[model samples]
Target: MGTDETTGAEPRATLEGFLRARRDRVRPEDVGLPGSGRRRVPGLRREEVAILAGVSTDYYMRLEQGRERNPSPQVLDALARALLLDGEATDHLHRLALAGGRRSRGAARPERVNPHLLRLLDRWSDTPAFVLGGTLDVVARNRLAAALHADFTVTDNLARMTFLDPAARGFHRDWDRSAAAVVAELHKAAGARADDPRLSALVGELSLRSTDFRTLWARHDVRGKSGGAKRLHHSAVGPLDLHYESFTVNNADGHGQQLVVYQAEPGSPSEEALALLGSLHTLYPENGPEAGAGTRTGRA
Candidate 1:
């Protein structure tokens, strides 16, 4: 989502741009209205959209114009259904609405993990260690995570896969449980930042596209994703039952970043598989000579 001439760096304008683009794609006839004469704005009228979404024309106008940034989850959903956005579009909208002030998408370009922490991953090659966001976006994963949840990182979001990806249906042994977790994380984000325009748009898009998402969201389940057990069927290692621990890193700037680690039982085939992954990880070649090894802190 690119911003334009007058838009600020607050991320609100990018969301506005997306909404305007989607708003343009839908013709009047697509939603049961017969085409009349040449019109200025392409799709539905402001009043029509506002009425359909159960919002005031002035407020919706401000939203479309990027003047207003706060819209509740329910209002965003109403707008999404009215716009007829697909699952991916819906998720994008939600991410935008929940992004707060962060500009670039997908977790502020993803802060790099510490070298020592990465070393830990290198050591535990038989285990799975990856960083996942509150949305279960597989931020980064080691060899074992790639093996266990093969398709997790391929997509931008876990919820998007639950609705759109074919492999998700097959790969996730407990599909319902996975789906519930996805929705719960999304709900938590929504609760945390009720005014994020991007988050609002994403929720709207998902609700319109997937009936399953709609049903799950309606349950009002809110929970943070931290630790859990995942039963994985690796094409190479067969089946593995592993427990996971997910914790947030205290970014120097106070951003809530997390590091998720997964481990298998000792003397298990999963552990052996992890070892193979570690061996492979050690050969990655990018673990070059430490560049900033000699910095000294001044005494207070």
Candidate 2:
């Protein structure tokens, strides 16, 4: 395991941290075990997890303590079953175990959206489309997307806008759900590249600044942004119920760029509202110094 350069102490292994967090979320009765007596911890005891996973208590302890880093696939599967982890979380577990404290080899370069992709986004004049970099940075966005997110003080990063921007609560009708999903998506990305300095810095900033972010981040939930519905209260449109789809950009650079597009349901009130928003933008185009002045739209 790697040691912290400043402290000269070993950092907690990623696999160990993930295992401990997941273990703390599994209740005794969740896996058909008896929940009879009072316990010091919130979730299943370590020994109980061992029993459920069909592993020795000592071995399980070693796994949690980072002393044992190379568990076989069978053991990983058993542990996933024991913890009742979902598909995404199970995959995250396998990734952490496979990483085994190895840091990424080279420094990361700034992500650039392909010109072709930018043109594609511009073609969707009525839709809100943007490209998100590996650390959830808004690398490129169409005019509609820019207009939608005009309320944010900093639109460069989605995670920052979601947690730090004061407008986030007002924009996202379901603020709590939005917060949890953002944290979980960031967790999944961070898990894949544990040593990315940008991710580390962003996580640290959010953890220090937002109490809600700290709480959700500690849970270690892992999920990707695929497709979902969003309920938003736009400053101009009043209310919008939009569905969004995310696609991974298959670039040779492997920077994990994602193309996200948002649309309203056909014939719904939200569709009318969206159209009105588009028309408003067309009539009063935000150009020069006035672009992205006082509007508010959130990333779903």
Tell me, by lDDT, which candidate is best. Answer: 2
Q: For candidate 1, lDDT tens digit of each residue in 160-270? A: 757656667666677788788888677666544445454555566566666777667654445566888877555544566677787876641332446767778888876
Error of 1 at 84 (Å): 34
Provide the lDDT at 133 for model 1: 45
Q: Runs in model 1 with CA error above 4 Å?
A: 1-123, 252-254, 273-300
Rate residue 292 of model 1 by lDDT.
17
- Rate residue 32 of model 2 by lDDT: 93
lDDT per residue for candidate 2 within 85-149, as digits (tens), equals 99999888888887775656555775766767767876887888888888888777777777777
Residue pairs clashing in model 2 are 151-295
- CA lDDT, candidate 1, residue 225: 66
